[model samples]
Target: MKLYIKYMVSLRCKMLVKEELTKLGLGYASLNLGMVETMGEITHEKRVQLKNNLLKSGLELLDDKKSILIEKIKNVVVEMIHHTDEIPKINYSGYLSEKLGYDYTYLSNTFSEVKGITIQHYIIKHKIERVKELLLYDELNLTEIAYKLHYSSSAHLSNQFKKVTGLTPSYFKKLKEKRTQNLENL
Candidate 1:
């Protein structure tokens, strides 16, 4: 039996959930962003207990099918973009379809309906966020960040970053530097 959860997005959240489940003596086979596969069927009382426990942590146990599916989609994208060390080389539609075991068209339509944005645009947004993080880290140069994120070139990365953030990558870095300097002086 799988329990779908809402707002269980981060690793910290997942760990907290796992702790709750263990406390209740619920054995789970797997736990992903929005879904938990239990090792065995849960009794009604146990389910209710789990629900309440999740609620206490600001996570909701999902019952609605559409909401569950939407959460799965978001988690998959988030994991792929933010969690993975290497950006996938496969086409995203193909990757999502394969990972979710649904047709690309269905996933796309469902995601668009629920999120009010195309999957491609969502992906671009995440890529920009990752670029910002990398720029802030100050470890990798623009070209390397572009290549690591699998952008065709730095120019393309810069263009998309500017489009999403309304600031050039260099300017963003400079702003961070200025803030740090001000903090140090204080």
Candidate 2:
């Protein structure tokens, strides 16, 4: 049996799920972001218990096809941006289509209908959040950050950052530094 889970976005979440499954004596064949394959069919009572256990840890079991698909889309993008070292060279629509085995048009329509935002806009939002994370690290320069995130140029990145955040990356970095200094002073 396969199960889809919401908010299972990080490695720590996977660990928590595995721990819960072990405690329940459920054997799982494999686990992936937003998905798990069990070694055997689960009983309704056990499923209920599992659901309640997962809820305590802030995860939800999903049975709806549309919700599962949406969570798969989100997991793919989040894994690429936050967990991986390099962004793929292909365009996002094509990438998503190929990765998810659906027509790009269908995927776009479903994502827009369900998410209330275009898939492109969702990617941009995730990219901006990733940029904010890298900026906070203070490890990579703007040019490097742009390249790592697959932006065409630092100028493009700066423009987009300013558009989304209403502040330049440099200003963001300075604010982080000031906040760190304040924390240290305490």
Candidate 3:
């Protein structure tokens, strides 16, 4: 049985889900962000228990197809931005279409209808957020961050960053540093 879960975005969330499944004595074939493949069929009573347990830990079991597809889209984007080092070579439309076995047009329309934002815009938002995280880490320079996130150039990254955040990457980095310094001073 394949089950879809909501709010399963982080590695810590995955660990918690795994622990819960183990605690329930359910054997899972695989557990990915927002999805789990069970080795055996789950009884209704057990499913209800699993749902209750996951809810206690801030996760929700999804049953609706649209919600499941939306979660799949989110999981794909989240994995691309937060978990992977290499961006896919293809454009996001093609990537998502191929991954989800739907036409790009259909997926785009569904995403926009459901999310109230274009998928491209959602991707840009995630990319900018990822840039913020990398900036806070202080491990990669602007140029490297640009390349890592598949931005065309450092200037391109800077332009988008400024457009989205009203601050340059350098300014954001400086703000992060200042916050760190103040926290340490306390």
lDDT per model vs. reference? 0.91, 0.93, 0.93
Question: How does each model score on TM-score?
Answer: 0.93, 0.95, 0.95
RMSD (CA, angstroms), candidate 2: 1.1
Alpha-carbon shift of residue 36 in model 3 (angstroms)? 0.5
- Full candidate order by TM-score, most accurate first: 2, 3, 1
What does candidate 2's lDDT look like per residue over 41-68, in tens digits?
Answer: 9999999999999999999999898898
For model 3, the stretches where C-alpha displacement exceeds 4 angstroms are none
TM-score head-to-head 1 vs 2, winner: 2
Q: What is the number of backbone collisions in each predicted candidate, taken in the order shown?
A: 0, 0, 0
Name the TM-score of candidate 1: 0.93
Query: lDDT tens string, model 3, 163-183?
Result: 999999999999988998999
Considering lDDT, where higher is better, how would the candidates rank from best to worst? Answer: 3, 2, 1
lDDT for 109 (candidate 1):
93
